[model samples]
Target: MNSDLLILDYEPAHQPAFRALNHEWIAHYFTIEPIDNEMLDDPEGYILAPGGHIFMASHGGAIVGTCALIKEHKGVYELAKMAVSPRAQGLGIGWALGQAVVAKARQLGAHRVELLSNARLRPALALYAKLGFRHVPVPPTPYQRTNVKMVLDL
Candidate 1:
């Protein structure tokens, strides 16, 4: 993690950055689906209101990264919407955000965390594996781009 990077809880003022960061990465590699719009457009409703959490990464006073822990069931969370600014790539921001979200999940009494992703995202997969996530069977998902599923047991 970069010495100056700070991972903080989501704030309403950070909504634009959160949306932009996620939109950038999703549009770059895959199409943004309707579910993506639902979440990105109203994270407070779909995420935070449901006992989930979102984390934001700040470096040099700019919001460079974002991640979320979406409550799925009691003791389980879905790690989603993680994105790091391309300009801030290689600064360990993604790893830092991942760690922060995992820690947050644990703090929120989560026993497990899962994520939906694509096999094509090797770097992201590597980061998730490094964060203790393991590949699992892909279940039916709303996103057509998701071909990989991972879970981290707490």
Candidate 2:
């Protein structure tokens, strides 16, 4: 990661960057589902307003990646929408975003963090494991693309 890389909370101005970054990666691998459209279209409504948090990674003042922790239940959260710009993949931006989310989840008083991912995304799966997430049975989710689920206790 660059020394200049910064991870920060979501702002209204960051809405477009957040949607574009996630859409780029999702479109590259799978079609965006309606649920995806709904959430991406109004993150502050669906995410932040509902007791969740979103974070963005910026480099040289450009948004390069983003991730969010969506509250699933009291003290439980789902880590989702993690994406780095195609040009920034493999540069540890995703990992940095993940770490930031985990820390934020704890700060939010969460007891656990969970995520659903596709088996085809080996790199992401590895990153989750490296971040101390362990394999778990898939939970009900709107995304048909999910084939693997993981969880980490805070």
Q: For this target, which candidate reaches the highest lDDT against the unseen true structure?
A: 1
lDDT of 2 by residue, 1-154 (tens): 6787899989999999989998999999999999998998899999999999999999777899999999999999999999988777777898899999999999989999999999999999999999999998887777899999999999
Best by TM-score: 1
lDDT of each: 0.94, 0.92
In the range 110-146, model 1's lDDT, one tens digit per residue, is 9999999998899999999999999999999889999
User: Candidate 1: TM-score?
Assistant: 0.98
**TM-score per model over all chains:** 0.98, 0.96
TM-score for candidate 2? 0.96
* Position 106, candidate 2: lDDT: 94
Worst 10 residues of 2 by lDDT: 85-94
Clashing pairs in 2: none
Model 1 poorest 10 in a row by lDDT: 1-10
Give the poorly placed runs of model 1, Cα more than 4 Å off: none
Show where candidate 2 strays beyond 4 Å: none
